[model samples]
Structures are given as structure tokens and as C-alpha cells.
Target: MSIKSTKIFNSKQGMLIEGNSLELLESDENLSDLKGKVNLIITSPPFPLNQKKKYGNEKGEEYKNWFTKLAPIFSELLADDGSLVIEIGNAWEPERPVQSLLHLECLLGMVKHPDANLRLIQEFICYNPSKLPSPAQWVTVNRLRTVDSYTHVWWIAKNDFPKADNSKVLRPYSKSMEQLLKRQSYNSGKRPSEHQISEGGFLKDNGGSIAHNFFEMEALDEKRDVRLPHSVLSFSNTNSNDYFLKTCREKGITPHPARMSGGLVNFFIQFLTDEGDLVLDPFSGSNTTGYCAEKLNRKWVSFEIKEDYIEQACIRFSDPILKSPLKKMKA
Candidate 1:
């Protein structure tokens, strides 16, 4: 089980390793002291899709069993009050309008693992409005369906409540909320849905209102896409000219097509972890999680099997990009 892994890049803030995560997680000598010590584990493992990806994936029932078998190993590595956030893409049964429930079943299997004892904290939908309509036969040719434009993000932990503070991820107060705050006194009465409204507290401002679960985030440019203080995370899978992509083009290596969105990665890292908290990403394709964690001043460890992708991911942490975590976080 001891597979050779090379640390492509390292700094005071973070590090990246090139290797199969499953093999490394089970028996990596370097990670022996890290067991039960990671504060946050955020990852997007290759989905159980029918389509071919350069990183490869498993599909159908086989995918579920394979993913479930890793649950116990993940559980053993998580500290109490630590969070495991996984992003899963949906799959469809071939040549049909029916959507496969493989993602849901996978979540259930992980939660029910004998040694995991993981709890479902919340399920957030990452809406990508610009995604092209898929399954050409069912959508374009037959004209029978709308595009599946959203994916699922499962926040899991060992306990009902993990180490999280809503205040840390509060959204900006809107105009309506500002108006309410201006009018300190409110008409207390039974409103819609037969719920009674209070007077004093309703008009008070508590920094900013918490964000809802279903988040809609979009932008063409990575610099424009800022992760506001929010519990939920979303990003368009449309960043084609990022640091990793540019490096891949320069080096003649095909970039990881299924890289996790940068905005998505930043949200969970900031919300679930503190400045010095340790983060781990098992299937760290292109090491987006590692890059973002470094920006936020969180210590991170990334593992990837693809040598080319891992090599390209290191470009994000080189000289100019990561001279300092504080500089990157501000940018």
C-alpha cells in the first residue's frame, strides 16, 4: 500500500503530494501523525459518471461500494468536531429521462458505514446556470428534458453540530434589511403563514442575515467571483483562464477538466476552519483546495494520483502567486 509520492511544492502555509489518495490514506508513513487531527476535509472526488474524464471515475453500483468503503478510513482521520464537505455531481441512466440516485445512495452509504457514524449537516445545491444542456439524445434530439444545472454539496460531521460559527459567514445586509433597521419600531402582528411577528428584535440589526442553502453564484472572471460571508457555496464551472489552466497551456499538459471551483473551495475553507487549522483533500485534482486553503492561511495537505495534473497544480503556489498567504488572501 506504500505508493511513491513526491511533494511537488511546499511552504510555511501548505503542501501538495502526488499519489493515489486511497493508498496514501491507508498507509502513508508521512501522514501517520495526522490521523484524527485534520480540522476540515473538503474534497470533490471524481464523480460516478458514464462520461470519460482524464482523471478517470467509477460508475453505477460499483462506484457506490468503492466510495463507501473509504468512509471508515476518512472517519478515522477526522478530529471530533471536524467537518467533511464533499461535492458530488449527479448521473443519469443512459438513453432515458430518469436521473440516477447514485449520489444520494453514496451519501447514505457513507453515513451508515459501521465505523463512520457521520451525520448529515446540510445539503447545499451549487447552481450553475450557464452549464450546457447534457445528454444530447434526451435533451437536444428528443427535446424531452431541461439541463441538470446544479450539483450537491454534503456537509458532514461526527456530531449534530461541528465547530462552526454562523457569524463568520454572514452575508451583507440588503436594502430591505437596511430599511427595516432604519424604521426601528415595527407593527407587531400575526403575518403570512399564521406566524406572529415581534416588534423590537425584528427591527434590530445583527451584522448580516445568514445565507440560504440554495446559492446562485456566477461570473466569467475568477477575480470578479468573490465568496461573500455565506454558509453555502456556489461557482460556475467556467473558469478556463486561471493560473492552473495558463500553466497547463504553457507546459503542454492537459489541465484537470473536473477541478473544483475556486469560489466553492474558498467558502468552506473560511467557514469551517480558522487561520491555523489543518485541512486535507484526499482526491485533490489540480489542488484547488490546497491553493485556496493557502490563501486563507489554513495549513493544507493535498494528494493526487495524476502526475501531470499535480505538476500543473504546483504552478499556483510558485514564486509570485504564493510569496505570502496574506497577500493572496487579500487579492
Candidate 2:
């Protein structure tokens, strides 16, 4: 199963490998230490789009079979309490505005696959308010559907209690929460649904409030203590000034066409893994997961099939915040 691949580059905290993830994960000698030790495998694999893209993807029923076969291999790389998080975009039926259930079917396939002992932990919505109206024909020309602004992020794990801490990814307290903390009082009682709220429960100010899944674009300059995060993650992928994109433009290199937002990657890496824990991204397009994991002090390994993308992704490691310089190594 040993396949020829390049180790394009490495930062002190991460390494970017160019190869087929399936073969590498199962048999790469360099990755022997990672077996059963990965804390998180966070990736946004190529979607099952109706049309093929340069990055490579399978369409329709074939995609589900392709993904299900890979689930067991992914599970084998996790520690008992390790997690797998996937961000997959929605797809539509060919030539129609109707939605496709392929994403859900793929998820179910992974979970039900005989060799994988994985379970669904939770589902989060990664909302991009600034996203342009998609499915151009249906949303714009045909005027059939509204803008599709979010992707489904599924959190699955080998164990029910995966390594996760909500406090690590908390958001800033809301205005009402700040007011409540200032007042040091509020209504607390049983509701018609019979769930009782204690006066002290809401009064105790524990930094910020728990986060929800529904997130909207908020002012980035606003600073506050971390609060609990919601299931809805709000981040836009339109930042041209990002280090990866900026460097790519300056170097006359075309960046990976599909890139995940760093904010989304940062949230899960911090929430799912601790400092020095290992994270892996089997489909590390532009190495966003590796960058986020490195910034968070976690060791990471990224697998990309394209060498050019790996080379371009190394720009992320050039930031001064990284502990060491990037090393370029031949395969």
C-alpha cells in the first residue's frame, strides 16, 4: 500500500503531505506513529457536486460508496476518544431546484459501515452570510430558491465522549447577558414545559454565555471574553487579505479553488483537541486545518492529492506567530 508522495513542507507543528489519503493513512511508513493517536480528523472533503471540479470528486450514488469505504480507515486513526468533523456543502438534483439527500446518505453510510465504530455526535451549521447566491441557474436566472448560505458540519466520533471542551471555543457574552450580569438578578422559575430555572444559575457570571449553532456576521473588532459557542458558526470565506490568498496573489500562484474558512477550522481544533494533541486532515485543501491546528499549538498532518496546493498552502506557516521556520523536503 506504500504509494509515492511528496512531503511538500513542514512547520514545527505540522506537516503537509501530497498523496492519496486512503493509501497513506493505511500504509505510509512515515505516519506509523499517528495510528490510534490522532485527537481529531477535521476535513471538508470534495463534495458530491453534479459537475466535476479540478480538485476531484465523485458524483451521485458512486460518491456515497466511495465515502463509506473510507470511514473504517478514518476510524482506525482515532484514539478512543477522538473525533471526526466534516463540513460538506449541499447539492441539488440535476437541472432542478430540488435538493439532494446525498450528503445525509453519505453520513449514514459512514456511520452504518460495518467496519467503523463511529456515531454522530452533533451537527453544526457553518453560515456564510456574505456568500453569493448559489446554484446560479436556480437562484438567479430561474428565481426558484433563495441564497444557500450554509454548510452542514457533522461531528462524528468513535466514542460517545470524545475529547471536547465547550469552554475552549466560547464566544463573547451577548448584550442581554452583560445586562443580566450587571443587574445580578433575573426571573427564575418553572415554565409551562415544567423545566425550572434557578435564580443563581443564570445570575452566576461565568465569563460569556453558551454559544448557539445559528451564527450571523458580527463585527470582528469587538473584543470580549470567550463565551459558549452555538451550533451555528458564522464566518465568511471572502477575505482576500488572508495570508494564504495574499501570498498566492503576490507569487502569481492560483490558490486552491475551494478553501474552508480559518475561523471554522479554529473553532473545532480548539474545542476538540488540547495543546500538543495531534490532528489530521485527510482532505487538506490548501491546508487550512493544518494552519489552524498549528496556531492552536496542536501537532497536525495534512494530506492533499495535489502538490501545487500543498506548496501554496505553506504560505500559512510563514506568519511570524509560528514557532519555527517552514522546511521544504522532497518526497
Best by TM-score: 2
Tens-place lDDT per residue, model 1, 87-166, is 98889886578889888889999999988879899998887766677766788889898887788999999888788876
Model 1 misplacement above 4 A: 1-3, 6-8, 219-236, 240-242, 246-253, 319-321, 324-331
Displacement of residue 73 (Cα, Å) in model 1 is 0.9
Q: What value of lDDT does candidate 1 attain over all alpha carbons?
A: 0.77
TM-score of 1: 0.88
Report the C-alpha lDDT of model 2 over 198-260, residue by residue, as the tens digit: 978888777666666644444323474323354223334677766667778899988777787
In each prediction, how many residue pairs overlap at the backbone (N, C-alpha, C within less than 3 A)? 0, 11
